[model samples]
Target: MLTITDLSLQRGGVWLLQAVSLTVQPGQRVAIVGANGAGKSSLFQLLLGQLTPEQGSVALPGGCRIAHMAQEVKASDRSARDFVLDGDLDLRRMEAELADAEARGDDHAQARIHGELDIHEAWSASRRAETLLRGLGFSDYDIGRPVSAFSGGWRIRLNLAQALMRPSDLLLLDEPTNHLDLDACLWLENWLRRYPGTLLFISHDRDFMDRGATHLVHFDQQKLELYTGNYTAFEGQRSERLAQQQAGFERQQARIAEIQRFIDRFKAKATKARQAQSRVKALERMERIAPAHIDSPFSFEFPLSEKVSNPLLSIRNGQAGHGTAPILTGINLTLLPGSRIGLLGPNGAGKSTLMDGLRGEKTLLAGDRTCGEHLAIGYFAQHQLESLDLDASPFLHLQRLSPKASEQSIRNFLGGFDFHGDEALSAIRSFSGGEKARVALAIIAWQRPNLLLLDEPTNHLDLEMRQALTMALQNFEGAIVVVSHDRHLLRNTVDEFWLVNDGRVQEYEGDLEDYERWLADRRKDDTEAPRNNQVTSNGVPAEASAGEGVGESADDRKARKRAEAALRQKLSPYRKRQTGLEKEMDGLQQTLQTLEADLANPALYDADGQARLKELLGKQAEAKSRMEDIEAEWLEVSETVESLEAELAG
Candidate 1:
């Protein structure tokens, strides 16, 4: 357990965190959220005792240990295994002392050393160290590799493992998932979901917070508000709170108006002078909150480019590879201008290979590929960011990347991405993964390419940046082919998906969630299908089939067939309700858009129109409430159906 009482911190004469007080109890997951630099990291540092507050105190329970994983980690000239093993420095040293004493034939010294060694050899300590190392994605080979040889991302992971290895009662993690790939992030999510220790993590990963967090601690407007739920639940609660706050303020304003009217009518007559004075005093004493400013979603409209011919990029049975092995084969695909296509599959499902082919980097095995005339393309790779020189500062990196841009323009561009002041001068090597990703994005934006190929582009971007990028891409007139695992981002940004599987690509209409649901259904067939089908159980079949009845049994007329049919019938309504709910949500969104446009019109300033707008806002709230209820019902129904179906199939 840890408590902060009257905590305040200042940097560069500006109060970053002031008079913040909160208690973090054992077995609680607290998410520290704020606008980019609302002192989330500084608060974590204060709790970790790395930084002392300018005022107040941090009180920890007696004998409570704390561990912290900061956003950035420096790679040193040491093997990754050695770096993690170094977490037990005291134990290792003690063991060495014991070995030395035993070889010296000094019985008295050996007796003392044995007691020290016994304390260091605790089973809990070893188990925790092993768990931390493995949870952070260090295999046997990785454990032995020198830290110097590892990429900056791997070094960050190693540092995280080392910090977590400490026997800490409370863990403070700052943006822990920024450097992690999909596989490692999933492992970490599962691990943290069941972790017993108190966790106070600062992250921009909405999905991770939705799964791992039990409480949300929002630091905003020089105050902290605690919400008792995960991110989605917290979002709903925050919306309600803001609405109530606004309503209360409006009521107060109306009361003040009434007081003003009464004072104006009576005060001049001297019959209600005292009342007028009292009303004035009351107005002075009212501790009103400044009207809350809700951030509207980022608005973006890309400058439209001239229309180009169809088949922006054509791969006619293209064959692409590296060295003697082929990464992709028989890849016949065509990209069209203005298409927002999401490339889906696992990490090495040949998405990048196809991108390389489109970029015309490798030899096509036996087919022709063509690029449209006047096609200006931009390509982004997850590893491509590493090519930036670490020694260069952020400003220098940008200046070097685009020499034509003036210093003021470069600074302005960096500021748009939330990099300003000293941050712009910070060494590229010192930047967090999120910062680097922003730089990569800035580079892409500067080029103003007509076609964009992005691989895992959302990996290290913060929520706000992701939303901004989505807005930018949504408005861009050029074509975009993106490979990403972020379902939320992909769903919001992409118009369609190019499902890459089994050396071929299939087009699917709709958002990334559609692709995910389709994949989930396909995965169910692995165990249900014949052994010769070569389908894997994890949902990624060796070869994809185009149909809704992927894993459905072809023959089922047996003793349990009656039961199966009954289950299906029971599930049919829920499935139908789910479908109807999805359709209703779509229609509601369109209506909301129309109402929002009307409200934004300057002519709607009349009192009657304002009231009408307010009523529409209330309807929007009601629609949101209904949507949540429907989604919850659908989830419960689906879960029940799946459980029964799994049992019957077994």
Candidate 2:
């Protein structure tokens, strides 16, 4: 379905791909894997025609349609469902033509357009769009919300939904699960498993690729090679290939040594001289196989804390949430020196709230929360990426942390995290998401904290970095609590599972496969009892319809109607505030992003840009402060709405 021949590409004067060629057959799911900046995304761009190769040809089967998700989505005022439905360009175009035909009284053209619309399934577009949204963890109410009303991560979800809604012969997704919770990721995996099209995606999640991809493409050494299985299988093949290459290299070196020995012992001899000269020429012409390069770019471990406490942190009868409302209650948890717990729950199920409660970012609404004197915290959250100083380099960030530490020691330490040489001293404003995440982890590792709270830490990490992080976590001598969609990380690093759901936290006794079964059973129960307090996280109904399905006896149905009406009446104000706050936050964040982008430019440091720079910096600070306030208000309103809704259901 897709073919590339003799592909050569360059970016910013650097060669990315040279003489690369690959073919993807129809109905095959291919995963492109590589280290950061190894041109995985560049390959996608080339396939999408956004980038023109220096010398190559890319061909797709004639008339084949393509669908892809953009890495960055701009803020927009369009409703989420409508934005997704717009992916079906044919449906929208046919509707427009049909309207024109009707206005001109052209019955024949109108009929033709109607047939096209039917073929496009235009009538069901909205339903399909909404289903995609719901499966991606958007609440039913969120379907009609404006695109600008969601955060950046949620906007990324909208982009994924949009791509999934489009009918195509091929689909390309880049890090599709980066922002998704595990529940949403699972739904996506199931959806892709049933997708009747060629699939190619860039994913850093090992377990996701293992479950979804049927083929692997590794971008390495300025070449692209195809393998015949999932990520794990690819690893096996790669390991064997490297072993063979190493064996060849060793054998060639031994042969060369033999040739050299013959040359040294038999040189200047009338008979042996001819043979020695031939051996030298043969050695010169022989192609050398490069040794297998298996070292990870990252190698760092969390330093042990200065002091240890048996139970570093404790919370009893804790009601945790923002403001006066509680999102999670009856929370009794204790963190010990060796605790390694992974938080598992559906989206909006208080996993992040638990992290915040543990981090003391959110105060307890009721009950007691305590900490040991040596309970140092190293919390890593997505928001911290934005909180980083764009003007400061990694070296400066660390230097600010520990002014007493020698620069050489710090640089050596940073080198382990792959921020070497100028990269260590360079501004981080233009760093990719993975680079920024590494910097955050580097700071946390340097802190030597006894307790760690990490939320979605692997969102933008690559596979190698994630493995390094897993190893680091395994060797750490601290209590760790993490909320991540990367199942591989959770399985390899964490020792216990804490399931947070239905406003409570409990220990789950099974592995990830068991959690999947639990989710499936919970979904079945939610379908049977749609309005119960035990809500299915993604709002999935029994059917794939956009709206709720009716399922109750006449008396029970009437009671539900009455209760829904009352709940709606009470929630009306909070919902309104919720929308308003979301819009306000989006606008503020957009403004902040613009300012940050402007501040990131090197020219902003010059004399001419100083005036403008100063103005933007001031505005940036104001926008950020307002963003925080709006977020706090939004959290309060959302918590109130959720609590009231749960109460109504109960």
Which candidate number has the best lDDT? 2
lDDT of each: 0.65, 0.79
Residue lDDT tens for model 1, 1-650? 77888878876687887787888778899887777667888787777677877888999877566777745556676656456656655556765775687688776675555444333333234345545655555654455456777777677787787766554567788888776654456556766775557899987777778878999898877677888988666666665556566664674465446445533543464643443454454344322311222342223333444556576888777677675467677777777766677787544457777777788876344568787886777888778778977888778877887788799988877777767888888888977766788777777776667788887787767666765675566556678888765554554445556767676767754443354455446432112111112233553333432322445664543434455445544554454465556556555665666767666766558775787777877887887787787778768876875676576445
List candidate 1 segments past 4 Å from native: 70-78, 88-94, 97-101, 104-141, 241-293, 296-298, 344-353, 362-367, 381-443, 446-448, 476-478, 495-650
Off by over 4 Å in 2: 105-108, 244-293, 524-650
C-alpha-based local distance difference test score of model 2: 0.79
lDDT of 2 by residue, 1-650 (tens): 89999999989998889998899999899999887788988988888889999998999987677889976788888989879988877677786887798799886676556544433545346667777888889986687778999999999999998888777878999999999999989888888987878899999897899999999999888999999988877876775566555554674465446445534543555643444454455335322321222446777889989998778999999998877779899999899887888999988888988888887765567777789988899999999999999999999999999999999999999998999999999999999988999999999999899898999999888887887787677667789999999987776566678999999999887767789988877652122111111113463322322334457578886776567655655664575578678767756766776787778888989998999888988998888888888888889998998898678546
Q: Model 2 residue 450 lDDT?
A: 88
**Model 1, TM vs. native:** 0.60
Measured against the true structure, the TM-scores of the candidates, in listed sequence, are: 0.60, 0.74
